[model samples]
Target: MDEIITRLQRIENLLEHLQAERVSKEFYSIAEVAQMVGRSEYTVREWCRHERVRGQKSRVGCGGTTEWRISHAELLRIQNEGPLPIAKRFG
Candidate 1:
């Protein structure tokens, strides 16, 4: 009975530690973000090229190669903003 109580207490302590730890959501790569938004990777690249949105290079995973990271909040903002309007010219 005492051994079981000790094991339970240990488990409770571990759970508390886990609950206290802060876990951050990792930024997604441009390709991953493109797929997430249901658009081609090139289109995302173009957006970045035109400065339509902000992104940065982040080294995630192995190989030490940096990839473009888009903020989820920024993506949602862009999505909410909708597509750009077409320009009209008058002669």
Candidate 2:
């Protein structure tokens, strides 16, 4: 279908523009995701909150909050579905 083709093209453009940073077989931090998606760390966190990217917020020792851990699967999900809704662009 034309819609599917258009959607894939859009995803391809995003991936190319993002330098197509393929994720490794490990969890990634917000900063890493920001770099991969060419967005800001804040936006990545927002994506986690919005469920755009599946993330885990586990508490560290002494009740300290640990940074979100994103899996490669989430990145693939974004690649298939689309990019996060970033309010501003980053370089």
Candidate 3:
């Protein structure tokens, strides 16, 4: 009984550590975020484009073009809560 409880506690600790390490990254690409959130890459990209989520365009290479990169904190927020509020655009 005591041994079983000890093993359970150890397992829980390991799980917690793994969870922390999972999001310890500074940023995540759209594909990675999509996999984590169980959504399509296109969907995630669209979210970035629509300003539904927080992200920034990062330079992928020496080229002038850039791609979206989401921060770890934003990813956590999206997982726990949801996307940010929709902003009303004024013409």
**Top candidate (TM-score):** 3
Residue-level lDDT of model 3, residues 1-91, one tens digit each, is 9999999999999999999886578999999999999999998898888888899998888877899999999999989987766667511
Judged by lDDT against the true structure, how good is candidate 2? 0.78
Candidate rank order under lDDT: 3, 2, 1
lDDT of 3: 0.89
RMSD (Cα, Å) for all candidates, in order, is 7.1, 13.4, 3.9
Query: Which prediction has more favorable lDDT, 1 or 2?
Result: 2
Deviating ranges (above 4 Å) for candidate 1: 1-26, 60-64, 83-91
Instruction: Write down the lDDT of every candidate, Cα atoms only.
Output: 0.71, 0.78, 0.89
- Write out the backbone clash pairs for model 2: none
Candidate 2 or 1, higher TM-score: 2
Q: Please give, for residues 26-86, the per-residue lDDT of candidate 2 as tens digits.
A: 7778888888778899988988877667889866678686878888888777667766654
User: Least accurate stretch of 10 residues (summed lDDT) in model 2?
Assistant: 82-91
- The RMSD (Cα, Å) of candidate 3 is 3.9
Per-residue accuracy of model 1 over 48-81 as CA lDDT, tens digit each: 6566667777786788987678877767766788
TM-score of each candidate structure, all chains considered together: 0.52, 0.55, 0.69
Off by over 4 Å in 2: 1-23, 60-63, 83-91
Error of 1 at 40 (Å): 0.3
